[model samples]
Target: MKHITFYLDFISPYAYLAFEKLPAALEGVSHSVTYQPILFAGLLKHHGQLGPAEIPGKREWTYRQVLWQAHEHGIPMQMPSAHPFNPLALLRLAIACGPNRFVCETIFRHAWRGGADAADAARVQALQQQLAPGRDPASDDVKNALKQATNDAIARGLFGVPTFAVDDKLFWGFDALSMLRAYLLGDAWFATTWDAATRPTSALVRPARG
Candidate 1:
């Protein structure tokens, strides 16, 4: 069985998109998925993504084009206005939910599919109310939990969400997940004959001394 750790943020449209279809993609495969919530914008900055506005016009246009692709997958998404940079609160709530599958799945679906402004105080609280009865997403306990999760995330060298880790390999981006599934299945034949345990033949060959 392969273990997959899914690190993601609610603010990421691609991450939201991945959540909908990734489970089905892994169906019948021996796998387990764990949620690890991290700060998306901070990670992007570290990866040299100078925010959306700084993107080259051509690249930005191409990105906007991908939004249309969301519809093909039956995902509801758009560049929400006033998207907040702070995902720490949401991350905290996910972490608090821990291995509670129902809780995590519910929040993810609502935030992504329902267009919930997760960072908004009232909206986030309302979501909590719906999901957990008396549990408040805006409560002091939730706030403290989020703070602790953010601290932990930073200490772990995490930079982004929807970051999937299979074994020792870390795959970022929704597009890269295809490669991740291939790895999990021990099937490199589709793209190449290389085995995960063995490096490509070229990389393994030693140079003759001149």
Candidate 2:
């Protein structure tokens, strides 16, 4: 069976939205979903990109858009009061879960739906204990796994959370989920490749206007 690698960061509202809808979006499809947690800050820094909240216009738009999307999807959502919170403990807790869907969902819901602050180490530890009793998130093994998974994501050319990867092809954002489903179902459009030989030079450069 084909597998889809879902790269996620708990701090991203977009990632939370994607997590809620992805299961139904891929229903009846023969594929496995692998949830991999990575640091969103690391990806942003590596790619020299800013988070949505970093910009003025984009910040307001992002909050409004996420609320609209949650309503459209019929899922309960509340924006966490804290923006740009650290996700280290959250990611490590996911690593401790080791592909447990229940744990992933619980954490996502707690952070996004419940509007809980995930950056608090004590709160994260409590959540981890609820999901996996007596599990140590700060263990060397769990820490190493998260670090390696993050580096692997960077190596795969991923610059954002909620990215889906099937083999070598990558689809980014919640909006791309439909395109991903089409591609997975063997759509001919996905098979087509752009050829540089057919490019129009006129469109490549714009004429200067006085």
* Residue 112 error, candidate 2, Å: 0.5
- Evaluated against the true structure, the overall lDDT of model 1 is 0.64
TM-score of each: 0.71, 0.88
* Candidate 2 backbone collisions, by pair: none
lDDT by residue (tens digit), candidate 2, 105-137: 888887887666766667776787787834578
**True-vs-predicted CA distance for residue 193, candidate 2, Å:** 4.0
Badly placed stretches (over 4 Å) of model 1 are 45-49, 53-63, 114-116, 133-158, 188-210
Q: Show where candidate 2 strays beyond 4 Å.
A: 133-135, 194-210
